[model samples]
Target: MYRLKPGIKQNPQRRWELPDRIFFGHGACHILAGTYLEIAPLKGFHAERIIPGDGFAGNHIFVTDGEIAFDFHGYSLRNKLLLHHTSGWARVSDPGWYCRIEDVDFNLLDTRALNARKMLGPDQYFGDPRIRARSFLERIDHIDSVKKLARNVD
Candidate 1:
């Protein structure tokens, strides 16, 4: 028989609801995927940054309006992972896979500092960061492959 892992449970009432409008300038948007996001240029004149160790609890889903270049727990990557209408961004570390919304331009709003303070919180899980990183990297690889295939067909 198989058993569920600790902190992993099936919610009978789980649902997925996409927001009507997920654009920049919106305060904080909550999604059905258990992620909370805020747009860039949060409230100051600096680029927003999310450090996993700084009280950033739970899995976050961020969509940046502009390119976000940073190193996740030491792994460096340039560019935002997710994009949407609101120019919102996230910094999550959950083990589950997340949906990716594509085709949005990056914003250079100077609210990163303020948004950092407001957005920083305790994460729900601190499982293996490598596992989560690998998952995201795999997704990125898959996206790149699809894009290359499309280009080849064209």
Candidate 2:
């Protein structure tokens, strides 16, 4: 059985935000196609075509069957890493999409689901055993710290 997961929590302190201009819908290739057309000023990437289908929250966007192409500026390892890490199911949270890379097959993902699944790595998609253990320990530590602080206050 397919299991749908809850969306990720965005960091409230982050400075960056997705522009409100990007409208999401399930069969809205026209909107996506228009956004691609407008992004030409950026000069590095362009959408070749848009195939309409379902996405996260039942939104739609155009997506290619194979790898999507984009152009980059001069050699920069940091930029390369950013692009690489953000690709596939790795960057879903940027658009409020909740799907994860290692958890779902990309070929079968619709635009909405793909968007939702972006940004999540295998560790975030699936809980890490070590982290879970550490979290319990951290909770204990937090209680101890709070007790000490309370005693000092008293």
Which structure among the candidates has the greatest lDDT? 2
Task: Write one digit per residue (lDDT tens) for candidate 1, span 81-149.
Answer: 323211232323344323433322323122353245443112211232223333333333434543554
State the TM-score for model 1: 0.22
The whole-model lDDT of each prediction reads 0.27, 0.29
lDDT for 70 in candidate 1 is 18
- Runs off by more than 4 Å, candidate 2: 1-25, 48-154
Residues 9-74, candidate 2: write the lDDT tens digits. 243112112211211121222233333334332234323322212363322223221233221111
Best by TM-score: 1
RMSD of model 2 against the true structure: 20.3
Q: Where is model 2 poorest over a 10-residue stretch in terms of lDDT?
A: 15-24
